[model samples]
Structures are given as structure tokens and as C-alpha cells.
Target: MRMVTKKQVPPLLLALGASVLALVFLLAFQGWIAHGADIFLSLAQAGLSWCF
Candidate 1:
């Protein structure tokens, strides 16, 4: 006879993790993250231009 063990995650912890992931996805879909990235990229380009 073979014995099998299954591991289960707590529902509260799973729900919290899922909520955080959903929030990040929502922000990304709404372009909030992209807006910050665009600002950072523009600043980097300006700094490099000054160095050149």
C-alpha cells in the first residue's frame, strides 16, 4: 500500500495573495505603472543626453 500526502494552503493567506496580484494587474491595466515607467525613462534619457 502506498501513502499519499497533500498539502493545502490556508484560505485567508491565499485570498490575500490573490488580492495583491489582482491589484497589481488592475493598476497595470489602467496604465498607472506605465505612466511611472515613462517618467523614469524620460528622466534617464535626459540625464544621458546631458552626459553626451
Candidate 2:
């Protein structure tokens, strides 16, 4: 098996950032989102917070 490398981190960070940003903007501007968007963002924010 191959080992994981630091190069993989940037993309995951970008994806997480985008998800968090979109969630924030949606909440502030649109006021609400569909089921999947809401759940996904909640999970992402929890993970990001946990990491930090």
C-alpha cells in the first residue's frame, strides 16, 4: 500500500472551505437550503471546528 502525502491536504482544505463559505452565504442571504445542503454543511462545519 502507498502512503498518504501532504499534497492531498490542499484540495481537501479547498473543498471544506468552499463548503463552509457557501453554507454561510446561503444562511445569511437565502435564509435556508434544501435537506442535503443543510446536512452536508452542518457536517462540514463540525469537522472543521473539530480539526481546529
Candidate 3:
């Protein structure tokens, strides 16, 4: 019997990271992230600001 007591990252954060990675991959495939990087970046910046 193994005692796995190590704490793990929260499931929600894991899921969010996975989803974000998938979205990044999809955008890369469409060349949208590269071409419109500034636009998306600004959106992300705005979103972060909204949290404060």
C-alpha cells in the first residue's frame, strides 16, 4: 500500500492551463496568434487589469 500524500495543483487550474494551451495551439494553426499577437496581447492585458 502506497501513501501518496503529496499535494497536487488544483484541478481547475490544470483544466484552465490545458484549455489555454489548446486554444494557443488552435490559434497557431490558423496563424492568428502570430499575425494578431498584439491584438490578443492587448486583450489579455485589459482582462488582467479588470481583475484589479
Candidate 4:
């Protein structure tokens, strides 16, 4: 009788999948990320009383 073996995911493949998911998330939120950074910079400038 032949035994059925479960296939395991390779570590490299797992890492690659995680990286791809991260990239997808970053691309999807690109606009929001830019907006957040802009807001943060504006607040920092205000705190420093920079009028430029």
C-alpha cells in the first residue's frame, strides 16, 4: 500500500508570498500613505512655526 504524503510549502515560497502581499497592500494604500505623510509634514511645519 502506498502512503499519501502531505506536501509542505517551501520557506522561500512562503517568504515570497508574504513579500508579494505586502507589496500589494502598499500599492493599494499608496494614496492614503501619501496623504498621511503630507499631513504629518504639515503638522511638523506648523509646530516649528515655518512659514514657507
Candidate 5:
């Protein structure tokens, strides 16, 4: 019987993960995500204010 002690992550997988993160940041910086986040935050704040 043989046992595997260690597992390795592929470089391609790491590169893909980094690229996806970078794309998300790029979009956020361009206001694609920031706009949506602003709307969400304002709605949440309004809702909280109305509750009190």
C-alpha cells in the first residue's frame, strides 16, 4: 500500500485565481461594482434609519 503525504497546487490554477481577482478589482474601480455597492449601502442605511 502507498500513501500520499503532500499535495501540490498547479501554477495555472494560481494564475487563474489571481487574474479573476484582478478583473474584479478593475471592474470595481471602474464603478461597475462600486455603483451597485453604493446603492446597496444607501438602501441599507435608509432601512436602518426608518427602523429607529
Candidate 6:
């Protein structure tokens, strides 16, 4: 049996794939996701405040 080497995913392609998945989730759960995003942003802001 021959060993097969794994190829790296290109950055643009990876970003596109992630964007597609995010779009799907957004479409499926717009309200819940929006609420979660708001909570996440608030937490991020709090963390950044401590850093600055």
C-alpha cells in the first residue's frame, strides 16, 4: 500500500467554505444566531476594554 500525503486547504477556499456554512446557519436560525452574536460581541468588547 502506498502512503498518500494530505494537501493543505488554500486560505481563500477555507474562508469561502466557512462563509458558506455560516450563511446556512444564519438562514436556519436567524433570530437565535443574531442574539448569540450580540452576546459574543458584548463579551469581546468587555475583553478588549481590559486590554486597552
Candidate 4 per-residue C-alpha lDDT over 1-52 given as tens digits, one digit per residue, 9 for 90 to 100? 9999999999999999999999999887996676866766877877952542
Query: For residues 1-52, what per-residue lDDT tens digits would candidate 3 score against the true structure?
Result: 9997988999999999999999999978788646566766687887853442
lDDT of each: 0.80, 0.72, 0.79, 0.82, 0.78, 0.80
In order of TM-score, best first, we have 4, 5, 1, 3, 6, 2
Best by TM-score: 4
lDDT of 6 by residue, 1-52 (tens): 9999999999999999999999988787877666866766777878853442
Q: In candidate 1, list every pair of residues with a backbone clash.
A: none
> What value does the lDDT take at residue 29 in candidate 4?
91
| Model 1 worst lDDT run, 10 consecutive residues | 43-52
Error of 4 at 13 (Å): 0.4
lDDT (10s digit) by residue, model 1, range 6-52: 98999999999999999999988778655866766777877853442
| TM-scores of all predicted structures | 0.49, 0.39, 0.48, 0.55, 0.51, 0.46
Using lDDT as the measure, the top candidate is 4
RMSD of each: 5.8, 13.5, 9.9, 7.8, 4.8, 8.3
lDDT for each residue of candidate 2 in 6-42, tens digit (9 for 90 to 100): 6555778999999999999978666544455676678
Error of 5 at 13 (Å): 0.5
Give the clash count for each candidate.
0, 0, 0, 0, 0, 0
Q: Distance (Å) between predicted and true CA of 18, model 1?
A: 0.8
* Model 3, CA-based lDDT: 0.79
